[model samples]
Target chain A: MTREGWTRLGLVAAGIAALEALCRTKVIKPLTLVPPSRMVHDLAGLLIAGDIFDDIGQTAIEVGGAFFLAIVLGVLMGAAIQATPRLRRAVAPVLASWYAVPSFVFYPLLVALFGLSTSPLIAIGVLSATPAMVVATIGGLDRVPRVLLRAARIHRLTAAQTLWLITLPSALPSLFTGLKLSFAYAFIGVIAGEFILSGGGIGYGIAYAYESFETPKMYALMLLVLIVAVGVNGALHAWEGRLLQRRQR
Target chain B: MTRLFDSLAIVAGILLLWTGVFEYAGDSAITGPLQTFRFAANLLGRADFWQHAQATLSAFGYALAISAVAGIALGLILGLHRFSGDVAEPMLASLYTIPKVTLYPLMLLVFGLGVSAKVAFGVIHGMIPVILFTLSAVKNIPQVLLRTAKALHLTPMQTATHLLAPAVLPEIISGLRIGFALTFLGVLIGEMFASQRGLGFLIINGINSHDVKRTTAVILIVITASVAANGALLALDRRAHH
Candidate 1:
């Protein structure tokens, strides 16, 4: 490992050690805080029990469904808006302003309409994330070089052909950034929806454990979430890195 | 004038779409804009809405203050040192990826089901971006500025206030805008989960009782407040950038 990596590992180890000591020594109440070792042990037990997988699967399916919807709808809407300067000007301020509002305000309405099912969660995810993708798509298309369009026109390329071969390729990098952001938003929305709506997923698991005062299980569930988040982030980072490499070549 | 007309046209188009959807779906709960606006206007006269708004805003304000102080301090400590920043950057990034709302239950446990939990939750959500942005701002300071500071034999405190603060203020302000938005969202979520008061709780109560008009009104209020706050911040950010 690099020096920086070693330093990070050391710091994390130190943090864990301190927490273990704090919990073991009873300086911190075990009722409120579970030591890392115990949490890990409990996590292993949960893994063996395997019931957590159902909740995980449910949350994953919702995330996937929401992300798909966001991408499809967002791209189409953004592309259409970008194609017209007047439309873009009309909507840009509204969209920018909307981005700041906590869309969770709409969550209650979603629940009222859809009930305590995964549908509400997925709907929230789509609503929260689609805007980011749309904005990114518009920005990406805006960044495409005018000269490229001129060249395509000179070559007598059909609008569809020019868009598919030239515009999309040029905008791919920005769109990917948007996709990554959309995933983060979707993940957050789904988890928050689960927490508030209280039906399924790791969020509900955590809330359930908290209500029942299952400290160890609660911490373990939190750990599972952290692990999943870190794993996905690392994968996304690696994918972006590979794309950048290919683009360079 | 044309832009104004265009914007109004788009707004009209959206209202028309919503009306069409409501008509087709025939869901009484999903009322048209006309009824929704009337309900919202009625809510303006109610004292309960303002009380709930106060609760939400107070929690947000306290959380923002704490995070701003804590984030800037931690950011400076970590950012000013190359070795510490390199060691800490990846760790922070990993933590950042985790959905912070998942930690709300933990906050409730630690701080109890009160304003404290809500404030703590908001701080957690808002503080990370501030710290990361501050760190980057510090790291990206021009070498010439640092060299000048060193050559002048300025004390650390002198350098911090005179050199570092001015250089990083704009970026920090911009970061605070995001921090403010996230913090507001966190407070809202916290209120929704367990609070007995706040705009979030008001909406949740409205939903639980199936009071569509009240819920819609609260939703509209929340949206308007957030959008207005964000617009103000955007203006401030633009001025700072200049």
Candidate 2:
């Protein structure tokens, strides 16, 4: 890692530490918000005593499968529409309308269709992920220079080869962007799924903690989720950075 | 022309599937769109619909007011102060990345089941984007404009009114538009997760009671409100650009 990266991270850590100390000292009290120190240990207890790993693990499975499905479908659909000019014009407007539909409104419909379990989570994830995936894939395909497609055609590359070598490679960056966004949405979708229907996901844990008035535990669980999110976001950033570096080489 | 047909084809295909599935499931609650639209219009004719809308819009008003005032103040503060901005910007950005909908429970506890909680939740969620956008806008304010104001010996307050306000007004307006959409999303989501009465409550009650038709109606109402809000904001944004 660069010195700059380490320094920026240190600054962030310092800021969090200062906030934690303020909370501990009663400077930020009457608020009684849990400091990061208490939060970290309490969060550790939640994982140790609580079935958080199982809940989070279950959520990951549903979201993973659903998001994967969306990417596969979205890329194929996006590419198909792109290849056929008539289809592209038809699909874009419809997709845009779907995009504007407040995603939360789908929960009732999903609950009716899927009836809890992993089904609802997957349904919600697909609903949320598909639009972003489709949009990004379409945008990526559209962005690839026309000359490149023509070159592939001139080379008489097979359809599969054309896609694998020309289209997919060209669209990789946008695809990565879509994946990052879809992953986040999928997480929300899973949480929403857990909220309704039969529950027992991390979302359910959070909701249960809230209803039972386990404020500290609820606060602790939230702190963990926040950390996990930061970790996941950082992981994606690093992955993308490495890919960009490899591309540069 | 053919593309238009293709669009209709997609809609028809979806409807066909929707009808087939609903029929097999043997439920009239949500039914199909056409049936729901008729019911939706009937819903509109009722005094209850207007009352529900009034409640929702009033909550929205409070949230919007909070978001606007808070967003501008925070945005300007972050924008003008470079060192603080540097120290805090990445952290804020990271926090933004946390899927906030998941934290609805904490917000529920903090704000209670009251409308103010709903408003405050919306404001916090919506404020970040506005802050980032306006901070950039302020940073982009021309050096020449500042110099000109100083040369005129304009007081700090006068300079703010004459120079900064005029310069950043358009960007601020744009931020407000974005803020409105996000605030609506946040408020409505909060209302849905926990609330006594609102469009969200109406939908949840409708669902719990197996009132699919009513749920569908509520969904339609929510969508229409979203569309209208988006349209209004877009128009406002365009007007502000001049």
Candidate 3:
């Protein structure tokens, strides 16, 4: 990163170009190995037509909606459980078991319950991410200094003040980590659900392409999804970095 | 007694929700927990479920065999040769970060939606995680361990056997456990996309036919497998600790 970023980028670019060349050489069947150039053409076409962009927008909305739901619900639930020991003892194992259940198992159930609409996709994402958020929130809260807790009690700070001043600030970094992970869960959860339910998604487009024998378009859609994923992941990292900076100062 | 009571209460509460919904709803797919369990029992008794499971499990085995050998070998190369890490780690990470389902079409095109495609898919899913984790494990070994091996006039193979391998065995096992789950997931997705038989196929079949119970059954099987896998992994981790 420090030494000539463009050179490193060019090396990576060249490697991809070489693979593209190998694919286009026709030594292997064109259908079997889509050249990078063809893939780029497909991508450019999709971008121009704007259907792919719409799918990307819908996916982002679902992911963002579910991520928001997980943060709010998970943090509140975590705090409630943490405030009450009996609740923690009663809920932790149950939550842990549910967490271990792959969210895909519920994708069909969600579709059955809510139909093939965005609800099912978003619902699965929420369910998948909430446990991670909840678990991390509790850990984050527990890591807050015991001295601070004692001092807060002694000062008789209001619940609102304690939450904002003591708990939230102390737990900020872990909270961000939890949210980062939740975003990741949301991404996979939405994709898997949409893939199964077969409508209004890049997943649906992918299945459509496969069934319709548009392999090049299928690969292009997947590339677009990957680009979106990397972008989202990078954003999450930057967000986490900001949180870390806040902690440092 | 408290533990049992707590667990029972939780189960009862969950069952209560399912039954309440089942009773109130008009001919919905969400059956009572008891009824679902009964159906699960019936499904379990059927040979078809096991056959589908076997199809999926077999693909997992082939993939595991490929990945374990190749990944560990690659990991060793990168771990022992510092230059490999410098040049290859980012390359590997880039591939690793690529969601890999993107390559599903490529595999299908070449392997034609068969068990071979599924195996290749599984290998792609599992190998990178194993390699990266194993590399870290090897890299984190005490320099003293390697120096001791050298002082004892250990050959490279002998050093790998006694020094590097033993040091990273726990991580290697950790990687394998994750690799197993990933292989299962990959094989399932491959089967789902295009395949003849597997739990994924059954689920897909159920979806296409609008057979909710059959679809839910496949989903349940996947959940059970995941729980069993996680439990087994935890047991392995405990064993390693001991």
Q: Give the alpha carbon lDDT tens digit for every residue of B1-242 in model 2.
A: 77668868987987797787677655643567688789999999999878877777888888888888877888899788866665556556567667686677657656778787778767876888788778878888999999998899999999999899988988998788767777777777777776776786787778778888888877877877776667666667668786
When 2 and 3 are scored with TM-score, the better candidate is 3
Query: Retained native contacts per candidate, as fractions?
Result: 0.70, 0.31, 0.27
lDDT of 2 at A14: 89
For model 1, the stretches where C-alpha displacement exceeds 4 angstroms are A112-116, A145-173, B17-31, B145-166
lDDT of 2 at A88: 77
Best by DockQ: 1
Q: Tell me candidate 2's TM-score on chain B.
A: 0.84
Question: Ten consecutive residues with minimal summed lDDT in candidate 3 chain B?
Answer: B25-34
Better of 1 and 3 by DockQ: 1
Worst 10 residues of 1 chain B by lDDT: B21-30
Model 2: residues >4 Å from true position, as ranges? A1-11, A25-32, A152-165, B1-14, B65-93, B130-179, B231-242
Top of the candidates by TM-score: 1
Ranking, lDDT, top scorer first: 1, 3, 2
Tell me, by lDDT, which candidate is best.
1
Instruction: After the best TM-score superposition of candidate 3, give how far the Cα of residue A105 lies from its true spot, in angstroms.
Output: 3.3
Q: Tell me the deviation in Å of residue B141 in model 3.
A: 4.3
| Tens-digit lDDT string for candidate 1 (B148-186) | 999999998999899999999988987788788888888
The digit string of per-residue lDDT tens for model 1 on A56-160 reads: 899999889998999998999999999998888888877777657888766766775677688989999999889889998998899889999999999999999
Q: Name the candidate, 2 or 3, with the larger DockQ value.
A: 3
Over A141-235, each residue of candidate 2 has an lDDT whose tens digit, in order, gives 88888898899999999989997878777788898878777777777677766765547777777778777877778778788678776787678
| Tens-digit lDDT track of model 3 for A1-249 | 523345556777997888787887776677776787787889999899987877777787888899899999899998888888887988876565564465676676666677768888889889978987898898899889999988999999998988888988888888876886687777777876766665777777776787789888987888777776766666776777787787789
